[model samples]
Target: MSTVTGSTTAAISSAVATTTAAAQASVQAAAQSIISGSTNSSMDTSSLVTALVNSKTAGQAATIAAEQTADNTLISAYGTLSAGLSALQAAILPLSDGATLNTFKTTLSGTGVTATAATGAVAGSYSLNVAQVATSQVLTSAGYNASTNLASGSATMTLTVNGQSSTISLNSSNSSIAGIASAINSANDNPGVTATVVTGSDGAHLVLQSNSTGASSGISIAISDSTSTDDLNKLAVTTTAGKSISSASDLTGTDSSGNTINPSQSTISGTGWTQTQAAQDSYFTLGGVGVSSSTNAVNTALSGVTLNLTSAAVGTTQTLTVAQDTSAESSAIDNFVTVYNTLVTTMGSLTTYNASSTSQGVLLGDSTLSVIQNQLAKIVGSGVGSGTTKTTLAAIGITLQADGTLSVDDTTLNAALQNNQSAVTSLFNPTTGIAAQLDDSITNYTSSGGIIQNRTDAINSDLTSLSNQQTTLTAWQAQLTSQYTAQFTALDTLMATMNNNSQYLTQLFGGTNSAGALATNKG
Candidate 1:
């Protein structure tokens, strides 16, 4: 709307504004870029450091993955070994050469058995020499006078053991048959002494017997306190201060003999504590026939254990048989198969790769996985050392599933155990069976180019290459952005200087020209 000169003035002002706006925009863009770099794009190093640590083994995912790798090896070994063992029982034969006639057996009749003299027979041939489970001895010190209730003569008696001694004493009130036993037992109640009251043809007399059994249970009592009738004939107290048997449980003290004695639990019923006789060989029973002890025959050709039981004295050899547990063996085989299948599947997942996927997921369908599967499949079919019977797991009850998993055939396994157990034992036991064979195989494979080892090596190599590429990409992006900023900033600065010079020239000409001089004169 203004005249020509005014329009020119407005145009110059517009140019200055445009130039200043351009410079401001360029400066702002540079500032924003620098801020953005400091806030988000610059390499802070902390994140990369964390990533490296995570990649190495600090993070949960990496640590667990690494640990699982080691665990798989050990678990696979155990599975292979267990699957190969043949089911068997303990090797020790029951009731063998150590057999001895322990019990006297007879019908309801009071008739006794005729004891035969064998190489092991101790004293009598037809009759057995059985040790006393319990005994009562009515002992009266030779020096002791029953009528006077005191030591009548110079007979002496003493009980000593373990350097401690207590002379036997009896009060007149305690002179009664039961009373004397009660008093002696009370005094010797500490450990080694076991005295009880028993009534027999001799009336009630204090029965003194060693509580210990065999050579260890003893009763040592000397005649130091002896009188003619009351003198102890078994033991002699030395001139030294006699240490008496202080307790019922002490092994060193006894009544008269040099036997160790320790009294056991005392009950009120007839079932009082008694010395346990040495356990002798005894026979178990079967069919009404009394199978003689000799029938318990054990044959080593079977390589299995045997337990022989007897019923009676006049019996012929009646063999008893123990069986191997087929159900358990089947279950164990099933577990091994299950775990093995899992391992196979896991291995497949590890090696298989999908070409369609741009992202790496699983390493399935790999050569390493195939090798692992082949090695494992061979284990079930493998044989043990010269095995006549037990060989294949499938022969017992193990079967593979459609998805390459395994299932146990319990029915077949049970039948095998019932029909032929020796074969089963040969198959599983490691000492001579396939179970041991598996251990050797696992050891061979996991050594170096083993499936797991080779796969791990490959994955690690790939990770290293991927990491290097990621670093290069980030650095290239940063360099490109820096180049773009430099080019744009230089162009903005050049535009700002040109616009400023153009404004300065327009103002100078308008202020000093002839038109300006004429205007001033008219004013």
Candidate 2:
């Protein structure tokens, strides 16, 4: 009875072991299937491709268009001043063989001025004293009407220069020491004489000054009006010319059109060159309204110049010369045209249609770009151009083509340049011409939302989607791993128990009955 029961148990154990092994294989197989199908990377790249279909592709094309537009703007701007550019660029470079910075000492001097302080900042006649006016301090000067205001208050004021005498009037309110000073300086306007109430420890005193530095430039002031009076209207002034012979006077120059040029404002003259002074020049106004005794002109004394407020004098006007980068401007113009021509040729070639198959090129058939290109052509053709100096594109190397593209007809351009230099110089100079407009247009296309924007946006959007998908996929993978682990572990435990019982039962039989052993046993 024991033998028969043991044999039956052994058979049962063997059957269960085989079943457990099969179950493990099934569990693992299922796990693998789940893992394979559940991986998030399994999503096709085709979907990403689909999402990037339209404007993204167009944006890539826009980069090329944008470059062409930039080229056009530069070239159009360059045409008017091509020749000067190379020289200007070269001159800007220092002898150090690289971009070099240089420090320079500049001195201001003219014929009529005496500088008290030679260097650094000192109290001054002129107040270059930089005062930051509070926004609130800006008195709306335009609203004040000078007609009703008292001019000056003083009795009889007489001025004599080299025995030439003039009668002057003065009002009390307008001719306080400050008013008399103002009137004296105002009377000496043509002679460059300036006056002001000089305040000292004692009290306020009327002081006279001149615009020139030399002995011939010294001016004398005599306050003939004993009673305080308004004295501004007392002196006579010449209509067109300025002659400051006294220390209180200042120099004034005017263009042929009678536009007065103040030394304080203009850096250059009509010819575009800096002014050269053999001696110092002085600036002054009456009653200290704009005059001062400090060595400085406005606030601090100007270097290389000396000013003396000894008396008032008529001052001479010095012609101003403007600084010009003619050579650099010329070269810049030439480079611009070159870039422009190259740009258009390149763009048209890239964007034009191919007579054959489905191979469309960059910017091909882009209508908006075509319009922009035409606009550039017009600028190169006949937009705002510099007058006289460089007025035409052909004067440079740029030539307009029948097809709306421009070319560097070097020979024609060189001739135009040689024959009419100013016309060529005026062509693309943006300061007053078409180049400015075209440059502005180019700016519009490259900014945010320009051609490159859409493509960049698409790439960013796609990357964001990819990141989200990865997160979700990673979570799915974790779940799959857990499921796989649990299923395999259960199978492993069952298999181990089954194999142990099968071995024990088989051993108990000693060698089970021949047929049963043969069916279940392994070699």
Candidate 3:
């Protein structure tokens, strides 16, 4: 027992001395009770066994608990450190890649025209005059009854738009005007065409409109009906190339019968189609040079800039000015500084040690945290390059403070972003920027299989070991309790028998001055 106790004590030398002393005192008290009670009555065997078992296992149990607590604290501390590093990484990613620094903004002087500038757009001012906005071709057929059958037996209607054609089978089931419109809309292979029925004062007019805007996106329909003179033949029309019509007068004024023509109604002439609206391209001028676009959104006219023109922009001249966005850049840099300072503060609290109060942080002497702090400080305090052209955070009004946090001067930062954009770009270059370096370091520290994860894994392993040790100690304690209980109970029975025997002997053979039965018989 002494050898086992010595070995256990040496293994858990860091266990609290008071706990071990208390266990020892309990065992001593139980032993004293047995010794003093030998002359009086049988000892409390159950309490003696419990005290002995507790004395043997108390140090090991306390050691396991303390070590497990320390390991858990370390694990939690690593989690906190990892979280701080991740937040800092998120704040610096955009700056590191130069996405935040290279942003551009566009200013337009007139209404109905909006412009957006992206990367590669140069700073400049240009005059833009929009002559016409693009429109889609809309063709309406002659008026017909809503329920009138347009086709007889099996027939096929092929609709073409923008050089792409789709043939939909039109039979007696879907030969009506409304049925034809529904078939056209539900056709899976439709080539950008929408059909609708407009109920005017005359009757229902089948309207076919191109789904796209441009000169080539005109709608044309061809029908092969069972009969030559079927009503479906009236729906057959050929595409007409769009022309620039400035006013209603530019359209055909009269039909062959000298009747005043209604341009809104379909008057199938030689082309077999009526053009309610032309499929003309958008016409605009940039810097006094004429340009045409198939859509209102003209992206090809300017490098890295898209111009959105509305109908109201026609015949109006607007000024488009492109410049770098300074405010966004400033905000991004400021956010980076703020997040970095927060990380620094968190790290300080984790690793601080108070000498006067004798209170230490959970990770006060952790080497991993120390190394991480040193690496970050080295990068932040150093400059990107050497010589006069070199730039640093200090040059951009971001300074490292005595307490390892950062301070930003907004006025200086804005000035640097506005005037010295090149230097700023160089400092935040995608490859060698300070933010990029910091991001890389943080990734290494916080990523899977990184330092923090490895440390946490090690601590968890220590906890598992402590649990196993605790399990073994509990088993030993149970075994020791059983053995002690048996031995003490047997000793208690023997002592009780001996005490009873002494009383019997005193009664039979009288002591000192008392006569016994044996003495009386001898006299």
Best by lDDT: 3
Candidate order by lDDT, highest to lowest? 3, 2, 1
Q: Give the candidate number with the greatest TM-score.
A: 3
Residue pairs with backbone overlap in model 3: none
State how far residue 481 of model 2 sits from its true place (Å).
2.4
Give lDDT: candidate 2, residue 31.
43
Off by over 4 Å in 3: 1-15, 32-42, 243-273, 509-523
Off-target runs (Cα >4 Å) in candidate 2 are 1-326, 337-395, 399-411, 421-434, 449-451, 498-523
Cα lDDT computed for each candidate against the true fold: 0.39, 0.40, 0.79
- Which candidate would rank higher by lDDT, 1 or 2? 2
TM-score of each: 0.39, 0.32, 0.88
Query: On residues 1-523, what C-alpha lDDT tens digit does candidate 1 reach at each position?
Result: 1111221233334444555555455444445543443433443233333333333222323223333343343344333332322111111111011111111111111111221122222221112211112121112222223333333333433443334455665443455545545655677433345556555553443455544322222333554433434323322312211222222122133546765543321211121122222211222223222111212331221223222222232223222323333344454555555556666566544444456653231333334435646755665556544446436666667665666665677688677766865556656664545445444555455556755555455545545554555466456545544554465456445555655665565554445433443454564
Q: What tens digits encode model 3's per-residue C-alpha lDDT throughout 1-523?
A: 1111221233345565667888899989888769855886669887789888988888777777766666676777788988889999999888899887778899999999989888778788889888778778888877777887877778999998877889988876777878888899999999998999898887778788888887778777888887876788777877665544444333335667898643322222323346687677777778877777678888898888999989988878899888899888888888899999999989988877665644456667677888999999988888588788778888888888999998998888888988989878877888888998998999888888888888777777777777788888988998998898888888888888888887777668877878666777784
Total backbone clashes of model 1?
69
lDDT for 190 in candidate 2 is 37
Residue 67 accuracy (lDDT) in model 3: 67
Worst 10 residues of 1 by lDDT: 87-96
